[model samples]
Target: MSTAFCFGIRFPMFICMSSFAIIPTSIVVERAIALWKRNKYEHYGCRLGFAISIICIVVSLIMSAWSMGKMNLSDLTVYCSATTNETADRITIICFTYCGIDVITLSGMAWLRTSNVAAMKGKYSDLRSSYQLRENASVIRVLLPLVVFDGLSHLVFSLGGGVFLLFRVHFSYVAYRTI
Candidate 1:
């Protein structure tokens, strides 16, 4: 029952965070392909950063699943309940690590996007005074917000995950004591 409730909370969060991670990845890939067609090798770093972010997102999801499994195991649950402080500390540490990785990846993507925007602005300045600059400006605007939102979401997730892990540790401890 406790396991079920733990999963109930994590499942929705996983879906939400995954969606946030995946959509920007798609945009990054699309823009990279477009820039590549234009012979802009400059955006390669941004592409690479987004690719890494995608990988980190996948790995984090896997870790979350594994942690859920550990929670479901009867022996581990019992142990966790008995050693609440220890369990909480360990869980908090793991969650903090995961969240830190997520934040770093998101920040990388954001920095890459910011650089891309700066480059585009410089490259398209003369073109900017023309109608063609519309597309260029639009891309800059789009990438800017995506990057910002992605980073912010990662930060929020990190904080939420840390808090949730702490709560789980306490809950496990209480359950163990009562049962």
Candidate 2:
């Protein structure tokens, strides 16, 4: 029961970080590309941010899928009731894989932040340096928040998933010991 509860709370975080995060990243990247082509230097920061966000989103999704598939819910149920030891062990292995996925997701998001910062300093010779601020205003205000939100969400989800897994393992261990 506790294991199920933990999963219920944490699973949504995984979904939000993996799937929902992609939307804003895509929108920002598309918008940024348009601005860059138009010689909009000011908005370059936003475009750069979007590009970073896209990279993060892609990595996060890939990691999430890998982790979730390895979890194999059917095997996991064994922890709560009688089942083949082989099946339960398989689920445990899957849980370990999910842990790796969380790490990959976090690392990718960190990279996105670093790359976005670099983009801020990137050169775009086609546009006058003077227009940097002017072009950047809209991008900064809109895309920055979106990127931050996605990144934060991913981090939160990763942590939450870990906590849920830990709790599940603890309870399962106690259950097995008592029985």
Model number with the top TM-score: 1
Model 1 C-alpha lDDT per residue in residues 1-179, reported as the tens digit of each score: 36455456665575455445455655555544444343443436576667766775776576545444444433333222311333445445655664665565566555555655565555443432333234534675667676667657766776776786666635654563453
User: Cα miss at 116, model 1 (Å)?
Assistant: 2.6
Name the best candidate (by lDDT): 1
Give the poorly placed runs of model 2, Cα more than 4 Å off.
1-16, 21-61, 71-133, 172-179
- The TM-score between candidate 2 and the true structure equals 0.39
Q: State every prediction's TM-score relative to the real structure.
A: 0.47, 0.39
Candidate 2, position 15, lDDT: 51
Clashing pairs in 2: 42-132, 42-135, 42-136, 43-135, 43-136
RMSD of 1: 7.2
Candidate lDDT values, in order? 0.53, 0.49
lDDT of 2 by residue, 76-125 (tens): 44244311233344334444444445445444444544544455576656
